[model samples]
Target chain A: MVSITSSRLVRGREARRAAPALERPGVAWAIPGLVFFILFAIVPMAGVVYLSLTRWDGLSTPQFTGLHNWWRFFSDGQILQSTLVTAVLLVGNILVQAPISILLGVWSAGYQRNRAVLSTIFFFPLLLSTAATAVMWRQLLDPNFGIPPKLADLLGGNTDLLGGQKGAIACLIVVTSWQFIPFHTLIYQGAARAIPLTLYQAAAIDGAGRVRQFFHITLPQLRNSIITSTTFMVVGGLTAFDIVLLLTNGGPGTDTSILPFAMYQTAFRTYDYGYASVIASFLLLLATGASLLLVKISGYDKMTSTMEGL
Target chain B: MRRRRNVVAGFAAFAWLLVIGVPLYALVNTAIQPESKYTDGGPVSIPSAVTLDNFRTVIHSGFLHYVWNTVLVAALTVAIVLLLGVPISYAVVRGRGWMTRGVFRLFLLGLAVPSQAVIIPLFLLINRLGLYDSLWGIALPTAAFALPVSVLVLSGGMRDISASLYEAMALDGARPARILVNLVIPLSRSSIATTCVFTALQAWNGFLFPLIMTQSNDTKLVPLGLYNFVSQYGGNVPALLAAVLMSAVPILIVYLFARRALVMGLMGAGGK
Candidate 1:
């Protein structure tokens, strides 16, 4: 029996060795994709950096301005306010959306029953276009004829949830979180489901309660996913554009203007392309820095051993 | 204890239902209600009078044309992404040495650069290429953006194909092209489907590119159309909601059919 097994293994090796040799495919196959990547992504990214150093409107030839745009970006009051608003949104996402999504994810994972229905309901908002979501919320929050104001009136408080400056940022955060919580929840759900059943069983056998088991096992296990989702949310919140643009147009007097909206207004609405590029570059650095920090915290090595496909 | 836990879980689920269901209910309910009812009744009130007149008004005002433009752009983007992403992923999977790894890393860099940061330059490039205000302009960049994730997912799919299968095909003297067609393409169907849905979603929902690159009415996509509709008819809530619902239906149908694959793909990418 040993001889037979050895002979079979030897024969398999021989067959593999005797296979017809074809030249291994080369990097030329990646050329077409790389061409498109270079033109559409790489060159354009480089152009933003270049444009930040030059003064150019859409119609005229660009003039080199030697860091004037950068200086202006640092000192500009409106840009600074937009940055503050973006920071608030990021904090709100981390504080509100992250914990809620994690709770929902863990709950659904543990419960098992109705998990499908629950996840479907939560993920429904992710399917809608940001523009559609913005429009839906805009109508729903209209002060004169909307639900929030009406509900507030019924409760004996008079306020404009979306139309007033003080409430606009909070409203933006709520709408943004409403739209994105599902995405984070899905990520957390994936992580929660991946926890070994044996771990939970062992904890249960040790007389640990459900909450104790979750605190001991689930939260630690979910660290990576939480970090990943936080990165997505932070970067997303900082660069939020469409919803803010459509919902308020950075409105109630620029109170809801995040960085991307500010950048858009600078470029398209005001035709200040150079200054817009400065904001764009700043945002790019901020997103890249935040992502790198999270990735490091999560210990995500890009060339993972699994990628070697051994 | 178990019964109490069940009650809590049930309550949590119910709370979630109300949270998500109410907004969706508002969307559909507002869409179907007559304009007068929308104006007169509270925003959350159930409509006494239901009508498709708002939808008819939206359709007559060339909403369908914008939908078609968006569909065309999305289809073309998916086509281009599949055409380019598949071969590139296969090559990245099979090719030896550092160059292939370098190329893969190059594509991965695309994920870090948001479209907003680069739209100004993209606008300039599109204008320079004389493709500005064309569907191709939107489709091309959107496809470019989609390629990294597509390639990542496809390569992950390709990696799952056993080494023995490749060896057997090679022993049969099958060329690389045949192996790609017969082996890679057939095996990677799920990945391709996932990539297609993802790319389609990106293109269909894309606002920034269409907003910046295209100027003509002929080039208007659905999101832009919705934006313009709101700006032009700010008072007509029902008509606006009707338009939103109309635009959301096709994607909702796609999601209903492919929710599992879509969710799995997104989760996988996000986790990675």
Candidate 2:
């Protein structure tokens, strides 16, 4: 039996070694994309890094600013404020939105007929472009001409939802969460569907309640999926642009400007390319760091091992 | 056993439906209502009257040109992404060496680095290239930006094809190009379609790129066109909604047809 197992392992190794040699060239399959990314993406990023160090109004020649932009960025209260707002949005989206989606997804995944209906409705926001959705919701949230106050009045008192200082920020989060929940639900449902039913049966046999089973079996098993979904939300929130652009334009007097919009305002609105590049670099650092952290948190070993089939 | 679960799931799903369905109802309802009602808007319970009047007004307002311009850009963006993206993905997937892997990682970096961060340098790059105010100008940057994900998807799809199939064709003394055309192309149709839908939607709904990169109506895409409308006559609620509706139609049509793939594709594309 030992000899037979050893012989089979040797044969597997031999087959793997021979396979590529017998295979047609794979070089063509991979070079064009590699070259394209190197030229456009890598080179451009280098250019951005270089530009971040200089003072250029974009049309004129760049002058070396020698960390002036960086200094200004670090010192600026507005930048710090925008950073905080961005963090708030990111955290809020992940914290508030993720659990709701998990609940909804688990619910949706349990039944076929209901799954179809729920998915269709939940994904409508995903269909609407950010501009249209924002405009639509902007109207819905209008103080004088919107639904929130009217809905509130109908319930016996009037209150404005969009006019509060933090209300707009909350509204932005709500919209983003609404649009994003369907995608998270879909992803989680996919993960949940992949979980074995025998595990559930065993839990039932052990007389575990639904809540206990969910905590023990579902949540632990869904760590990778949850981390991935939350990472997208975090990165997405950090780069939040259009919805904020369309809904409030970072307004109620610049209360909603995240790092991305701040980068926009610095560049096009302010026409300070150098300063904008600095902001861009900061955003780049933040996004890259967050992504790397997510990869780590999601457990790289498990992902890499399982990623072969995925 | 399944029956009990289905009952509870069915109710939960219905609740989910109401959440997304209601807002959309409100939006479509607001568009058809009269201007006074829109401005005096409260809870928009129902449409007071049906009118193509708002749609007519939007079309007559010369947004037709804007609509045309946007379509032109999106089409060009898709065309460019496919043209360049397919070959690039082919190389990244089948090519040899650490350099290939390194270059692929650079594209991954693009996913993390949002376009807003680079808006300053990107605008400079576009202007200096003398692409300012040209449809190609918007198309080029959009395509360049979109390359990472397109290549990612295509390469992932390509990786799924069996090596033996390519080998069989090669043994027949088929050229490399022939093998890719016959095997890789056919095998990657679903992924390619998904990528195309994605690139088109991104280009269609792209705002900041067009806003900074293009100055006038000549190169303006739909998002820019809509933004311009809002800046101009945002107070004209019905007209704005009508224009918004017009701008959304093409994408909505595409979305309606490909909702499943589009939704799943977006999740997959972003998940990585």
Candidate 3:
């Protein structure tokens, strides 16, 4: 009993919908990527776990010594300290970077005239590798010639930034934020643009001020992007190696030495592949567990734009 | 209300600009200055003498060769990611049953795995393959790590193609391959670009792989080269900063010429 006027429209849609089975690729199409990914990614994941149980140098075959490295890893005071430092760096980075990225992301999403120019300037940091950013800051953090001495009083006369644990950690966060905020901001910018202007206009009519509109409207609208950006931050923070290596070298008697650095120092410097693999295994678990937690909590796996229902 | 809000936002933006700009300004200002004068004025002061000597020093130190190796790695990485990521994404989007869905989940799981965590085993694997100290060794694992993101972004793009478009192609008797060639690829152009840009950046800017898998100067990528520069130059701040700037040149050129495409590609990684 379709209306006569809509009969043609219905028929056309029906004609198109009936062709679902056409051009469906088989499971074989996925084999190449699967094989490659498994060979490189999955195999290594399993290998790290296996290596944790073995004693081996780079030059020799691994000897199976069940849970010996694990036992040592737990007892090791440095590992605990490194774990604490890693946690602090991770939390500090998020605290510093997330709000800055969200604010900049929202601000840059405006249709104002200078947004594009400012964005391009902001995009400069992303162009530089973490190595370069760290190196440049290393020079700038130099007590005599860098910004530290010039602003010695503001820093409470602590010009030796990389010397103290707290200062070193602060420097690491600032550097990490500087290098990475632009990327997350870009993510938020895209999400912010997808938000409807009508929502704001409607809120205005309800006597909501701009700040209220942002709190009630823009913040809620950016929920998914917030999750996405924070997820990246977590994964990146867990495996943070380069900046730590370049900027601090896990210095001041390994006080700033996070897990990855400790693992590298064990494997390459001390040639203790077995213990290194223990740290590696711990890193693998932490990274995957944290990401899984974030995904589960944020419902990020069910990724849809905030505007999906609208 | 609008005016006042704009004022606050503007002031914040200005302050942020300085935060971003000052470091960059310091980087450039220091790079052009001769090493002797760098400490006299410190990082903030205008250079007493602007010279290309720092850049010259970088070039002479085999910057171009390292750049070439990096380019090779970036190219190989982009090629591998696209060749593998596109088909799998297509299969994930259109193919039926549990296998494809599981594969998608595997990649989602992989999004958590970082290259550093796997480097020890990756080192052993690369050694077992007899590819240690080779560019191929670095490129292979780098591509592998980038695959999850590649698949995620590409599949996101492929899903946007209206079912009607696929049906139209099917109605025209197009097989899966032909439909992929004729319809899917064209529609997925932006995603492919995103994949290309992202993977290229991953490879180009990669550090840990090259650090562990390849040690020799011949195989050293740019970031690794920069690592060496820190030791070799030894407090030659101007020369070191110049090298850092050089490491960014190729991608910076891409960023300058193809900014919109590069930006859109980065935005695509937002997984919307």
Candidate whose TM-score is highest: 3
Query: Candidate 1, after superposition: displacement of residue B86 in Å?
Result: 1.3
i-RMS of candidate 1: 2.3
* Model 1 quality (TM-score): 0.92
- Candidate closer to the true structure by lDDT (higher is better), 1 or 3: 3
* DockQ metric for all predictions: 0.57, 0.39, 0.62
Candidate 1 whole-model C-alpha lDDT, 0 to 1: 0.83
For model 1, what is the alpha-carbon lDDT of residue B212? Answer: 90
For candidate 2 chain B, the 10 contiguous residues with the lowest summed lDDT are B1-10
Model 2 lDDT per residue over A224-291, tens place? 78888888887888788988888888887878888888888887777788888888888888888887
Write model 3 residue lDDT over A88-200, tens digit each, in one string.
99999999999999999998888777987898899899999989999999999998889898898898998999998888999999999999999998998888998988898
Answer with 1 or 2, whichever has the higher lDDT.
1
lDDT of 1 by residue, A1-310 (tens): 9966886686567569755455456788888988888989899889999999999988989999989999988889998899888898889768989888998887766555577667777888887889999999998887778777667857357557766766788888788888888888888887898888889788878888867977899999998888889888877887789988998889888998899999999999999999999999998888878866864676532644344643
Q: After superposition, how far is residue B10 of candidate 2 from its true place, in Å?
A: 5.5
Error of 2 at A293 (Å): 3.5
Docking class of 1: medium
